[model samples]
Target: MGADREGGARHRPVRAVAYATCGVVLLAGCASMPDTGDLRDVESTPRQDTQVRVFAMPPREDAGPGEIVQGFLEALTSDDPNYDTARKYLSAEAARKWDPERSTTVLANGPGTAEDNQTGGREDSGNLTYTLVGSRVATVDAQQAYSPAEGPYSRKVHLSRDPKSRQWRIDALPAGVVMGKSDFQRNYMSVNKYYFASNSPAVATGQSATVADPVFVRKRVDPMTQMVRSLLDGPTNWLGPVVRSSFPTGSALQKGVSSLTPDDQNKLIVPLNDRASRAGSGKCAEMATQLLFTMQNLTPAVDSVELQGPSGKRLCELNDDQAVKRPEYLYFLDGKHQMVRIAGATSTSAVPVPGALGTGDRELRSVAVSRDEHTAAGVSIDGKSLYVTELASGASLGDPVVQSHGATTDDRLTTPSWDSHGDLWVADRDRANPRLLLLEQGAGRPVEVQTPELSGRMRIKDVRVAADGVRIALVVEKDHKQSLLVGRIERDEKAGEQPVVTVRGQRSTTPGWEEVTAMSWAGDSRLVVVGREQGGVLQMRYVQVDGSAPDGLAPAALPGVKTIAASEDDRVPLVAYSDDGIVRLPSGGQWQTVVKEGSAPVYPG
Candidate 1:
């Protein structure tokens, strides 16, 4: 099913405070009596399937130093909107200086506290210190960007007795909130902020090629308002170079606009400040389109978005269909090793493409059609040679554009992929001399792309370049395990010098999977991955580029999936080669057999 349709069904509104009492049970485990003075193992309480609202209690009068520290740490994981209760455990000056929004540090387990001062126990002492320690898992920056982290984490919290009340209070602490992995997952959700590809020709012509910049935001905390603010604030630091926001510079939501809710008709009206009043009709429409795409995953599904100026004048409006693209044709190789295509998601019959590669004159193992659908690149059955051919009836099979010298078929070239810029990319798995090559416009000498981050025994198993031409997803093998990673593509094009293409900032997108068998870009920032976790059965799930799962349920189970195909346009059904033969999952429908003998299914790039 299309991601949008499936997401709508999965995102229906649920009570936010369904399990209010559960918070006491979860947080009580972190606290200790004033007399014990003992350190306990810190662990995260498992999250429930439904939304949970955790309310934290304020520190009691005359609380001991250990109790104050534990109360503050437990409060960090609560749903207290402004963290007011958490601040109660801090001194007056420290409470005023603390900024919980600075950044969030996630630990493998919840933070554990240990008394650092060696002085003999004395209630008369005015000062104390405690050590907070845990293993780091990931971090969320001020921009709401999530990045996986590793290694040990250690910080200090200082406490002092209040001269007026003679109560223990935290004098100093970390800048932002700290929590365990489970609490992080429960408190924040992954959201994709839409932007236009900065380098695409479509942008110059007033058209848009949508790109997704994923970020994390607090759930049930007026998320609609947060998402709108994030969209206007622009893309994150890592993706800022390749994408551009449609909102005008200095544009922001109207002052004092704390909550944004869609109307009964599911139409959202966004009121912008005076800075956006100067935007023309065309630019306003583009801005509305960006919001429309960004709000697709929200509950009740916003059917339309309208942009309003400072004076409450409607500048432009956009509907869901107007902002989303429909799926194109589905391309694949038949049992006879011929490239064929179906019209679209609803088409029942498949026809051989009008090209030399479809005539079966030259046997092929796998094929990739260019984004424009004018040309195709195929790898031989033995996987030694790579050929490019025209999609014309009279065209002839030409000479091999590239060849591999691997000793066996399994070590030869992988399936080729095309970027939106018409460039072709493939990885030669030759153990003796492996390399990633890029062919500009699918012709001429292939250039070896630089991947300095992929050192050691890492080897590329599969490659899929995003439609934006600036990001590439690769399945790499290391130590007999397969992992999916996404990297940025930077091209240095000088008029008189050779172009140098490099892949940098590679990050793991499926760290838990032991084997990533196959994957395809299912949406702007989402991929449908087929893989298995350690000692687990193979399954298919949609994961964002940031290694976080999306909001909807996973795709229905399929057996022995060898290859999968999906389009960036979510309107298309997902096609896969499985034990049941070629099957498709239609929107709001089950997987149905498309053909009994097809392999290597793919959609136009």
Candidate 2:
């Protein structure tokens, strides 16, 4: 009913450690033990013809190995095409070689394929050549496998001695071939085929068979015997199918099924109902949900899913299961509309209301969003405090604030804004000494800017810190008249002696720009201001640093918009707040809808 609990690797066998030295002691030890599962002996024949003949025996029958090898070399390299002429000097057994099956000549090269100057072709050679570095047992090497298209080639040969004749020869050459999984498996199984062919009759007759190559047997099949021994010696209940299923299979799917852990594969083929019957409610629900979700996505059992409230009322229906798994995150709505968290199969247990923002316990000081929705600012609640916790994860960052007497009390603290260099700036809103605090990169207290000329009779409505954090702009009521004041901060070692300058417009300013609700840097040189007048209509205006004011960019229809967020590239303004839903405005000649009002937009950083 449930998954099996045991598993084992496929056909792993015990192997003997091979030593490089082949002395009497090694041979004696190898002779005493017969390695299991090797069947390569069927292909080895001691009686096979093993002589190499030449057109003439060299003058040095006992010549040094080098001189004897040179004679064989001359025979093969004398002609443009070496095969026919080279075959003439070979012994009857070697000369009669012909592979009608195409297997032996799979990589052989033909005429005009050898690039030797004796061959009449400019193209690259495509033949593998074994150089006769003298006869006897001096050395064996290969010339490059020539290719017509490529000019260069290199090769190495496998040299071996004939066991029966006790003579040396270049018996094998390296094959530059890569086998696919099927081919490898097929060839791998052939070793077993020969083993069984040689041993089955001996086992049936109750007689011992001569051992095959000890090196090959121990290298390959002995490990499977060990694996079988381990499985048989362990607990029998769980190991049966695990051992049996660990073999190569008919197809990839079958192989994949075979390859899984015994438990997982059993879980796959076993009935889910049976497994669930024994599971506790919690475990059952978890498993069932995963299975149901997987099946719902992969199969066509259900048409759609309707999320209902506890009262049996439908909340939201999703045609796509993919959408249900990741419902849009709604951040700009209040309790009356958007549901922040949902619980259970039904959606009745929704939690978290909008506007009632969580500021990570008492750690966050202040928070503010720009009217244009392009910028947001926050600082610590107390003037003495420096860093505040991020509302989402409680991470901390240093924020600058204008120290006011009542900053520690219930007095409203201004939200600190960030500039391009990650500096924070906020105004001392409650004090008679209302000054601008410019937070910089030093280790001590913040540097303050006080301009009595800019502070008198001024009730700051909105304050904006520019991208440099060195520039401060504000909409203040000075002398009972609303005015726009732009100033630069003079940094110094002291706490509050820096001077500020008011930038004058071309007309020396008419009435000074008024009703500025929020401000942010629109570009390197421009500032966007979101504000409203007596009519309660919202207006977004862009102005240069040197200018007084400019015309509105967005229409006056958005009266309830409060906060704005900008795209990473600053190409769009997402105006969002918690009242009716969420709203996004892309910066274009005309506004177009990207995210609907009711669905929350997951802000990607």
Candidate 3:
């Protein structure tokens, strides 16, 4: 053994018994055991109701190769800050070469060792090899980006016994760490890394719409510092092209400043390197805003963030209230099929808006209001036509801007969504020819948006454009199952040519759900989704655009949900159409009936 040599000798007598007892308790609590088959399959460990702190114990004297390997695997999942105890089972050289933070491989279950498959020389030769195997679930890379992974996983662990002490030690092993899905969830949490939308027109106006890039970081392992570093590192590869960081090129945290904590007043002071000092006051303020938003979910909630240059001079500061806008009214169809509005956070009663659509001139199916709240779009009850009109009183509903030729309502147009740029987007699911269309300012000729991956068996079921106008969330159907996908919105404009638009690099944001019934953008990069896992009941939860589960408890469950709505400003209550008709969930409150009959609840983009 490596560092365990001294400690192992001193505690061998006492810890040996304790380790056996702990092992028994852990095994008893396991949901299922690994079977002795060609592929040893172990179920994920059940999560405990209360937090359990597990400490790693140094290896006992003269441990066998199997014991050393098992102990090392167990230690990797412990609460050890630096995994010092895990290294104790490795050879000195192997321990020095290991880099646990390189990446994390999550498996459906804890890895199982196959002792029967052990190879290499006999015990006398002091050389042996064992295999650890499991089914891969996902991976968190060096940049903290999380991606779902599939297929079987197998790795070899080589061991050699010290000739003098005759103690088995790992001489070679895989880099990073591997653990069951439950353990991974216990150790890691998702954080949103804010970035400016590169293609948004708002950026040119100095407003710079923010887009969230979610990443996973260890929950108890200096997460504040980890999140800061991840933010400076830029967006994940999938979102890189559509977003830009406000921090100057090569900007980084001041060297040797590792841990970060908010002060008693909930202010976090960040010290940046020389590169950040080059930014002007305006850009520096944007950078501070990014930090304020990124750190908003930390425990106790950071109220403000202040950035300092290398020379310890203040660059800028931003408070939470100044960094984000307050949510507006909740919009939905009333019992009479007329559009109605209510205060998103407080109103209990709903009233029709001042417009032709609100006056019930034409029956509506679903609706979307522009970000400016100056205009509105509505789909026909038959899902065949889309109508646009102003929100002002006496404003007339114009002729259908777009229509679908589908034979039935189930195969026609979906609810419309307006982007920050005032553009409108929707999917026409006509069985003969399904297509996604976008309109300029909600009035121009529909542009057929290209979606190469959505052909063949897949078709768009619903559409929700993000506030940044650079991303779109879509519910896609294939073989009767619906999946939520987030795709980058790419626009190509050339002189004298029709501006081409495409939804590219689409990735599933609801990998765990077998069917996604409805979803809405709840924040810059978060969505409130109503879905169900295979053979599971329908449930509502918040998920990041990057396919990672966000921190905090999931919303209290509501049954029979048909559609859901959430505001970019999270302070707004969530509204949904369910068996009980229109229902709203206020902050820290249960679902309350808003009306006996209503459908297609929504918040302005």
Candidate 4:
């Protein structure tokens, strides 16, 4: 099958907020993206030109309404241009009104139940509705916005036979389309739009932490436009509650401009609607930061972001570095659980953490340093208690701020994690009543996290909250099967000083893989997972927050691995405990041992 120049299907973005162009236009817009699809690695399997391939044959001769419904649903998955074949399965009137691009309901691969409702109850007894039910994986909205869903879902198609032709064609149905997971990968592309943490205090300091909102866009369409519009539309429902956007409400792109083009200097030029005309310079700068961080992820990533106001006047321009997330102060505990640090990912030596915690006499089992490096939380070797110590000079250490009643020493708490909001999280893995607790300011009577998704048979093995306060990674085991899952942290909107956050929806980040013994956040939206295939040896790999692994060779195997730690920034190295003892992975090099005596090493977010 040949590849069609005309790309197929409804793809991504947030609802496009069109701006009223005040007679200002950029001629360099939408000038065709480089058509380099052929340059991609060729596939081994024979492919088909979806543009001409008939997905569903026009209902079999004199086909019944049930067949019409089935055929119509099948055609939607076919990448036919404008869904021309799908319309054939619809009545003339329905054909004119039916739109499969309104949205897409992606389902887990399986046979969807198609039931014919022919009870002969209505005035038009022959007129019927066919129901298609399945486990919905996600819903891509009319704007190409994707939102994951849980539980069950059903789709209804109304059909009536063409009396004159003695044939059936769908008459009524929802506007959106439905397809299995395989088709989704073929036509959809995933992109991340960066947004500053909604509740972070770093915003005031011009060093706000950013979070990644992953979204899917059509492969051949104006993805830069789709991504920009989606970023402006805000995060997905699951993530919206936990993040904030710099684009003020009502701000949008210039009307008729669907393409975001880069200037000769590779700086992206974003034309904004009048909604941002009144924004102060500072606000405009923040808005630019959001766009710079987001647009930099696109292919031929932009080096800078230039914002044009309603009047076409330059509001602001910012380089990618200027919009970078602040550098986190990293610290790890040495063999003695004493705070220490490595000069760089390739550095073979370690330095002591700042002040007393580095020189303290406390014997600890595990330690976690705050983002600011001002405090540290350590669990006792017995694992029954948690302690917090000031990292300042001669600062005193606090008594056990948290205690557990684990029946055995092995059923104790794991390492603690510090979020951008100064909150510490840890999991108490008591086999009987496992608990995930959030301790404010490094310690205290923990607030049992109310994430119902993590409840039930599974026991929590490890929990690490990302530097961005909105996400958490957990490794759990149930009936001997261990898996890695990530959850979005939600908090009360008005929970000002005393914030209360819970792990709302926890889903697998390393799906299908079992024996996920160790995992850590490698970046805002990436995780370094140490997983073992069923009955296979342990292998270390990287996975996205969306559960997809990075395409390429897995990192060199680090057998006999006990645990791992990674800096929140992807630029930082990934450190792990392996047969070679403490080892680190350079940017593009093999893993090299950094410390022979190190155990459970970590980079503080």
Candidate 5:
């Protein structure tokens, strides 16, 4: 998948294009072709209903060409369902062909220069032009795909007169719709669709590792139903191989039931097609988990979920408390290099891991814990080899999961990161053969991860995978500068074949920093990076995964900070190795020394 690969968008017969007009010929050409995706045709009733409210759409039938454009521009911001009222400004024929579902160009302001909204056209025919100006902030496609599109924008609405009605309306325009940011914010909501981790074996243990695929949906328009549909549609291609859906391959909503609605008691009733009836009790419970976790953000929240078959026969039912919550297990390498964990957010004491590995003689340089915390993969102090040890018994599962290929002593293995599904991610920066590897939770052999975007000469300093399993954060050395980058993880799992993992879309998380020493995911969309400007002291700051600085003050500086770790839970505390030794930031508290000998600290991803 490319940069636009994971975007979820919707469009049937509609096409949209963001145009930069220059020559008149190119401007006309912009109206000729469809952009975004392939166009398909679908039919629906045309309504300018007053009862169904959405964006504001004021009357514009009596307005002039300029006034019509201005009126429509103002009406576009109203929360009138489906922009039906906005359609009233269009000629009936144009209204029939125009599809707001094609795309939406969100602007910083609803519409600009509408005051000077000029019109140009011939007097003999029904053709006319209206230019509505504004700054484009982002574009959200019909499939709910969003992308930043910062720049000035021009909506050149080509209007034509309906031969019978003789009223001007937007006829040949761009494929997608356009709206202001304020209106978009009020109407859309961010939601996470839950899916089981394909690499996890927890299903046998009563709960599977759940991954959340975040997306934005229309808030008031049966959001729960839309969320479920999107979940059933499956994760985006980048995440497809990493996640599994409980809903069967061919399963769908029952015919004529386009959405799930809550009963009087606020319990959601989801009617699935007959395919869902084939699922066993275990499968039904998994499906219920997916639904309940997905709809947890809705207003009042869903207390329970009841799956119904085609004829309304009960399939499975689960209460809110039954949903599987995201798991967390924190561990760190102490002064003695023993694998130990923090007891609680407020507790300073560390506990030894259950297995011999926790108390064994082998000194660990870095450690990564599986979601189930049953096993851990650690890089030995020399960084020559990686070892997998059992947490309960201290028995060596694999003496050398992988060994270094680089020439020098500094060519070492980076800290390991474990995905929720139990796969371990680590980079062997041996200059001779620097490689990224993924260790299957229970399997011995390691799978090499390839990212063509990474420079061949670059050395991997650290690797951190997000709990969601869809993203990874990397500390790398290139051209002698240590940089921080985040990438989307994609996998190709073929039947009876070993799965191949690839990281393609690598993005900088600290674009302006000259060097990055340590980094970890602080939340789903944020990261804590220890960075410094050229010749400057290292400062630990909370930066968005997108590379923007979080609002307010940066987290208290970590003077002499060497390695850092933060919990996946945003509200959880942070820990780091500073000059003062193993120091940790308690929840809303100042940094305190947790262990004098601690070095590498990490929480379950």
Candidate 6:
């Protein structure tokens, strides 16, 4: 909606008060407060030029109706050049009608006999109140009761008089037709179309044409302009009034609209309903999806192994003794943690390293796993091209998709997640703060997701998908304070309301843990977090489905856990690190070191 404009419609302010009350659910981004519109007074007349009424008074205490009427006629048809001669003989009512200009013209043409009075025929049959303005003069109100086109029009005129001098004068009025307030309102409101063609020829009988007002033209063309315009136009039309009344008037929608006509009421409610429907439709539903994961290494891996979480089994391992050394490789695993496939396994220049090397960086710099555990995506540490491969066919989906941010770029990609559509959502933490980028199929530009609350002030440590593809998770760092935020991406098309997009923080159960590093979906609802304690102990924590803290949910004995993933059944989680190796922990807290390689493994969710 647009704002209210001046001169078009007048708006009156109504009394209202409001205070913000944040809810348990994310509500910080609520926009659009109520605005009130009051009725304005109307003052416009119909005729530009018209005659005035003249009343005449008599000398007697009680004058006959005919005598009073005759005096009024003589005053209206006065023939004195200066009007002084005529005014001297007028009774209080007659003097009021004697105009000097009219008298000059009448005298120039010479005064007529009594038969000339019969031409217009002045009548005074009813009792009309004559106010005494002076000792000898009194004046009665007059209505110009006749018109050339539409005869017998109603008009009210004020009369002035001098009682002592017995002088009277008729009031001057503008000439031509004029419309009243009711007429104007009826003409505007009764039409379906806001405006009709002013000068152009009309369209065909059944055709409709949009008027070409400059303001209207700008609104339809400029996306943001329309919103700003609505803001300005609200006071004049429905925008401001509806918003003020429906939202903050301390009145409910029904109650606030009760005073408006049925048509006006519908004008307000219909658009509001449409806005809510669009917001709801844009929200994601409950569903699972698979994402691809790939990482770059200073030294590439010579072997890849997959472990099945169910029954604590090893599924498959791929080993290449003399294969080409690849710079980075993205890996995908099945529900059983078996190696699905690795994409971007090509030659690189880095020297080989088998054991843990602080310099090697071999654990997949960028990775994204599909919800269904089928498709995977990976990018190198540098913001280079993205590699996506389907696990089922062991085939590359297409050529790598290049994504670069800065002028001088790194040959690496960033961590990519999946929105509901299984499209890739990645963040480049290489900048001042992590920036979000959405890559969709058949689209020329990636959707840039940057919020003022997150972009410059908060740094993104990790981006992950919830079990439900629609929910997004981010480990954001701001002011040295680390927090986990969960939110559904929502957009608000209406300018009057707040942008529906928002991110709310979750409760942290791990005490003294300043920041969270990674997250893996434990189920369709639950999520597991890897956090560093203030004492520098790497601990595993579980966050509930909702954004509540996972107090008392971390295991007491697990150590050096660099990464963690959930089992297919969600009954146990797999953890890996440089010291404790790969340990498996059941939901009941039983633990076992399943591997000693220290390869950072993600869950097969």
Clashes of each: 0, 20, 0, 2, 27, 64
Which residue window of length 10 is worst by lDDT in model 1?
Answer: 9-18
Ranking by lDDT: 1, 3, 4, 5, 6, 2
Q: Estimate the lDDT of model 4.
A: 0.67
Top lDDT hit:
1
lDDT of residue 541 for candidate 1: 86
User: Per-residue lDDT tens digits of candidate 6, residues 317-370?
Assistant: 222222222213223322222332322222111221111111123223444555
**Model 1 lDDT per residue over 444-538, tens place:** 99989999999769999999999878889999999999999998887777777657888888999887679999999887778999999989998
lDDT of 4 by residue, 1-605 (tens): 00000111111111221122233211111112112111111111122232222233445576655445555655555435467767887788988987766788877653254445354424246576656666677777765555556567666767776668867577887787776666565556566677777754563355676788776665534557878888888887667777888788888898978577678887998999888656888888878877766665545346777888876899888875432343354355577767676665556677776665577787677788777766888787788888777767777766777777888876888888888767888888887778888877766567777777765888888888987777888888888889888888876635445556678777776655779988887655667888777777778887777665443355677778878887655556667888787887776788887878766687765
- Candidate lDDT scores, in order, read 0.80, 0.30, 0.79, 0.67, 0.66, 0.33
Of 3 and 6, the candidate ahead on TM-score is 3
Cα error, candidate 2, residue 93 (Å): 99
Better structure of 2 and 6 per TM-score:
6
Q: How close is every model to the real structure, measured as TM-score?
A: 0.87, 0.32, 0.87, 0.75, 0.74, 0.36
The better candidate by TM-score, 5 or 6, is 5
Q: Lowest lDDT 10-mer window, candidate 2? A: 1-10
For candidate 3, write residues 318-424 as lDDT tens digits: 87663334546788898889999887566668889888889957989999999888899999988999999999998998789999999999899999999888889
The parts of candidate 6 lying over 4 Å away from their true place are 1-364, 381-383, 392-394, 402-414, 441-445, 479-481, 491-512, 533-536, 545-553, 567-569, 577-580, 587-590
Question: What is the TM-score ranking, best to worst?
Answer: 3, 1, 4, 5, 6, 2
Model 3 misses residue 392 by how many Å?
0.0
Q: For residues 316-418, what per-residue lDDT tens digits would candidate 2 score against the true structure?
A: 3323233212112223322233323222212223344222233222233434332222233334435334342233433334443344565444333455555
Q: Which is the better candidate, 1 or 4, if ranked by lDDT?
A: 1
For residues 20-107, write the lDDT of model 5, one tens digit per residue.
2222110010112111122211111123222233444345443445445545655554444477766777766777887877677777
Per-residue error for 303 in candidate 2, Å, reads: 53
